[model samples]
Target: MSTIFGIPTPALYGQILIGLINGSFYALLSLGLAVIFGLLRVINFAHGAQYMLGAFVAYLLLNYLGINYWLALIVAPLVVGAVAVVIERTMLSRLYGVDHLYGLLLTFGLALILEGAFRHWFGAAGQPYAAPSQLSGGVNLGFMFLPIYRGWVVVASLVICIGTWLLIEKTQLGAYLRAATENATLVQAFGVNVPLLLTLTYGLGAALAAFAGVLAAPIYQVSPLMGTNLIIVVFAVVVVGGMGSILGAIITGYVLGILEGLTKVFYPEASSIVIFVIMAIVLLVRPAGLFGREE
Candidate 1:
């Protein structure tokens, strides 16, 4: 068996693959966060709950409605996104123009409520979610055995990340969104419904979180607390990437994931806190974040 630095080659590759898988989730979650904070200026503390909601929505659709994984993937995000829209319009919109802390507190409370309700109803145990049949198998990549679903996850996440980047950076609607954030009064005077745009942006952020949850369901058990496990790490990713930086969030997530994976291979004890350490360093060195513009 060939070894790299005394570590088995297969083990090394396996960890790297695992790292990529984790990075995919991080990218998706942070991307949503960046979108919300970047455009809406809302801290959106409830993002984790929204992710959990997505998994539950998928789970419920499958168990009750006989909807398959593929269908649930489409339906879950829509359902969660709609709920987010309603929340934004009826509740979040009121907090606009106030301190960002107020919005954070509000969403934090909502997250607690949602998490508590789900935990009360469905215990703390994780519920299993099966992968689609088409992606159930595995493939050999010479040195490692790769699960099709895992590969799909990485590919899908990359595509989604790139697509979102293009949407915000290249599209006309994206330009309007950027414009509205910069000068809502001007955009509104020019006939754009700024409020509507804000609502939609919040909804889109929630939808991205939901989509990530659906992808995560099969890998991690569907549980009320599942989102809690990942939310902090993702927040760190967003911070390190530069809060509200779309491209920065995307790049930082994957890089941090890979770094964490390598840490596990070398110094296992530091794996859990490595990302946080990096976040602290970034905060001290560049408070605006890696991609955030200096004010």
Candidate 2:
């Protein structure tokens, strides 16, 4: 077995593929955080819970309602997003005039409540959710075998990330979002329903997180704690990429994922902590983050 840097070539490729898959999830979750923070200026802590909710929703739909994965993919996000709209309307909207910490605490509480409720109902163990029939195979790429479902995840995440970027940076509605972020009062004066936009933005962000959860369902066990475990790392990705930077979030996610994978290959001990180490370094060097603009 030929080795590269004392690591087997096969192992390296395998880790890279795994990294890409993980990167897809990171990109998606961070992108949603960026979008919501960019527009609402509120750090949404319940994002992870919402993500867990999405996976659970898919699991329920498939097992009980006979809903297929394809339909669950579309419906789960909508359900979670609608729930988010209600949260924003009933709870988050009131904190707009108060300190940002209030919003953070509120969302954090919401996250706890969601996770605890699910755990009570489902227990701590993860449930099984099979991939769709069409995606149940592998493609042998000479040096490595790639799972079709994982490849699909990567492709789908890329499409969603790019499409979201275009929607926020190119379209007319995107312009309104950016404008409102800068000056909500002024935009409201122009007859734009800024409050509705805020509600919709929250929903969209929640939907994005839910979509990532759906993509992740087949890859990982559908556990109540899954989102809680991943959220910290995703937050690190967001910070390293820079807060409120969509493109930055996307790029940083994939990059760090690869880095983490390589670390696992070379220094397995540091694999878990590599991202956080990088986050600390990035903050020390650039407080505004890699892609964030300084105030």
Candidate 3:
């Protein structure tokens, strides 16, 4: 068999595919975080709980009502988004003018409540969410066997990420969002409904996290604690990507995911800590992060 760097091509390709698949999740989750941070300046510690909620919602929908995955995909996000909207309208909104730390503390409390409730109800066991019938197979690529679902994940995530970026960077609505973040008081004076914008932005970020959870349901065990582990890693991703730049978060998330995957193949022990090491290096070199702008 052909080899690159003395590693079998199939083995190398397989690892790369794993990298890309993981990167897709990182990109989607971080994209949501970036959006909220860009607009509201909230750290959104509850993002992972929302993700776990998405998975649980999907599972509950399936088990209790015989609803399918596709329906859950849409419904779960809407439900989580609504919850997020309520959060913003009630608590987050009032904290907007206060110190950013308050928003963090409030959300962290909310996250604990949500996670505890889920664990109380569901216990620690993870439930399964089978892949949709259409995507439950693999294709033989020249170098290695490729899982269609995994490839589809990479393609779909890239499209979603780019589409979101364009919506925020190129569209008229995006222009308004960008403008609002810079000068909400001025934007409000201009009669743009800044309050509504803030509510919608938070909902959008929560919905994005839920969407990511749906995407991940089949690949990972659907469990209450799942989001807790990933959310911490994503924060690191945000720190490296530059909390100020939306595009930077997306790029750093995916790059780090792939790098982690590659490290798994070459040095399994380092895979766990590689992201933290990169975070340290980046912090030492560029305190604001690669895409972050100093205040």
Best by TM-score: 2
- Off-target runs (Cα >4 Å) in candidate 3 are none
Candidate of highest lDDT: 2
Residue ranges of candidate 2 with Cα displaced over 4 Å: none
Model 1 alpha-carbon drift over 4 Å, by segment: none
User: Across residues 1-295, which tens digit of lDDT does each residue of candidate 3 receive?
Assistant: 8987888878878888888888888899999999998889999999999999888889999899999989998999999999999999999999988999999999999999999999999898888899889988998876689888887778878988999999999998899899998988898898898889989999999998998888888889899999989999998998898888888989998999999999988899998889999999999999999999997
lDDT of 3 at 101: 96
lDDT of 3: 0.90
| Tens digit of per-residue lDDT, candidate 1, span 48-138 | 9999999999999999999998998889999999999999999999999799889989999999999999999999999999999999999
lDDT of 3 at 40: 95
Over the stretch 94-159, how does candidate 2's per-residue lDDT look in tens digits? 999998888888999999999999999999999999999999999998888888999999999999
Query: What 10-residue stretch in candidate 1 is worst by lDDT?
Result: 238-247
Question: What local lDDT score does residue 8 receive in model 1, on the 0 to 100 scale?
Answer: 90
Query: How far does residue 89 in candidate 3 sit from its true spot (Å)?
Result: 1.0
Question: Candidate 2 at 255: error in angstroms?
Answer: 0.7
Pairing residues by index, what is the TM-score of model 3? 0.97
* Clash pairs detected, candidate 2: none
Candidate 1 global TM-score: 0.98
